[model samples]
Target: MGHQQNALHVKDLNVAVKTPKGMLPLVQNLHLELKPGKILGLAGESGSGKTVTCMALLQLLNPKTMSVKGSIQLHGRELTDLNQKKMRSVLGRDIGFIMQNPMNAFTPVYTIGNQFVETIRSHTVLTKKQAVDLAITSMEKMNLPEPSKLMKKYPFQLSGGMLQRVMIAISMCLRPSVVIADEPTTALDVTNQLQVLRELDRLRTECGTSILLISHDLGVISELADDVAVMRNGRIIETADVFQLFDHPKQEYTKQLLQARPALLLNDQLKRRVI
Candidate 1:
């Protein structure tokens, strides 16, 4: 895709953690590009460096213990060399992140409303009332019940699904250009998973935010991604448009992954004929 159409681009990304013996690479020479208003599914096994790659892309990894190399460009602007202060400005404002666990995104001590207000204020010059309004509006968009009421509760008070939805609301509230959702549905049950996925889909449709959706479940990837990449042993084995990747995967690892998810494969088969 052309530079203007791409929301985020990666080239030769490498991430390694320090070990007593030597540097242990977790992600190697990874390349990915997400187009504006498109969803890119990044699928891999549990330890396949999917999360590591996401963290690296966002510059979230600790420099002291982990090392990252290569280019991460968000809208054609290089992010690898930015200082912490500048990166912080870019992080939530330009690039939103929806972590796997909602609690990881919020503080235990603060009320949900407090956190949301702070997040909104940090990026925009909106007043507290305006920020609260935006928060409630975002919650309403997610079909969250009684947005005002949920705001008073702590992170621990809400159910896992509710927390997930709340985090989604917060992440998308800023209207960031790109969103990196790491294992967003992993902790939710089937019902909540569908709800969360729907919210993500709505974000892309309504706001035109490009998404990098990382997940171990091929089923979830199949449901949301426009394009898909299969990763293993710190490398992407194959990538293609969603239907092509599911129906005629190029790599053995990708094939095995699809075979293991029999239900998803059946679903994809049905989808293929419809297309």
Candidate 2:
């Protein structure tokens, strides 16, 4: 889609960190676009600048130590120009972020309900009771059992899987236009991974929320992403439709990545045989 039609657009993006020597590039000349209600998967090996790209898009990196230069437009609104205060307003409301570790996403001292209600209240002018009700409702939609109970529990009390779902619920409660999910399912078990993936799929299909899904797992990307981009050494080596990239990778690096995951190929074969 064109820039005007995109839910999130990034062009000529570059990120660098200051070192004793000088500025060192971590991501360079990157371009990405997320269409409304679609998932774009970013796949790469660890240290390939995938997470750095996400941080730049969210404007979360420290400016004193890092530099992010680019045009990041969310629904045609330029985000790079916005001040920190303004960016805070846009973050959870306009763009939701799901981190790799759910535990790190929440405050250990606070109950889930406290954090959820506070987040909702901060973004919207809802009273505590109203926010509580909304949080329960959103948790229910995520298929969490005993939504009210879950809310009352502390983040440390819940399992990683449940906590991830709670995080997803919180992110989706506002129905942000775009969600930047950075390795969202990486820390979960098989069943929980599937559950998390299902919830993300439901968000795009039901809520019409666009997602930029960053993951090292090709299997996850193949399962959930509509389009895929391959990053290596601070640059995008290839990008194509999910099927096209998987079946016919153009770059040697992409080919090696696919080959490195023999189990993914085996799993695909097993499913096909069962079908």
Question: Could you tell me which 10 consecutive residues in candidate 2 have the lowest summed lDDT?
Answer: 266-275
Residue 85 shift from truth in candidate 1, angstroms:
0.8
Residue pairs with backbone overlap in model 1: none
lDDT of 1 by residue, 1-275 (tens): 54364789999999999999999999999999898899999999999999999989989899999999999999889999899999999988999999998878889999999999999999999999999999999999999999999999999999999999999999889899899999998898767887788788878888999999999989888888999989999999899999999889989899899877636543454345322
* Residue 200 displacement (Å), model 1: 0.7
Best by lDDT: 2
Which runs of model 2 end up more than 4 angstroms from their true locations?
2-4, 265-275
lDDT of every model, 2 decimals: 0.90, 0.91
* Tens digits of per-residue lDDT for model 2, 1-275: 44458999899999999999999999999999888889999999999999999999989999999999989999889999999999999999999999999999999999999999999999999989999999999999999999988878898899999999999999999999899999998999877887888888888888899999999888888888999999999999899999999999999999998877536643464345322
**Alpha-carbon error at 206 in model 1, in Å?**
0.8
Q: Compute each candidate's TM-score over C-alphas.
A: 0.94, 0.95
How well does model 2 score by local distance difference test? 0.91
RMSD of 2: 2.4
Cα RMSD to the true fold for all candidates: 2.7, 2.4
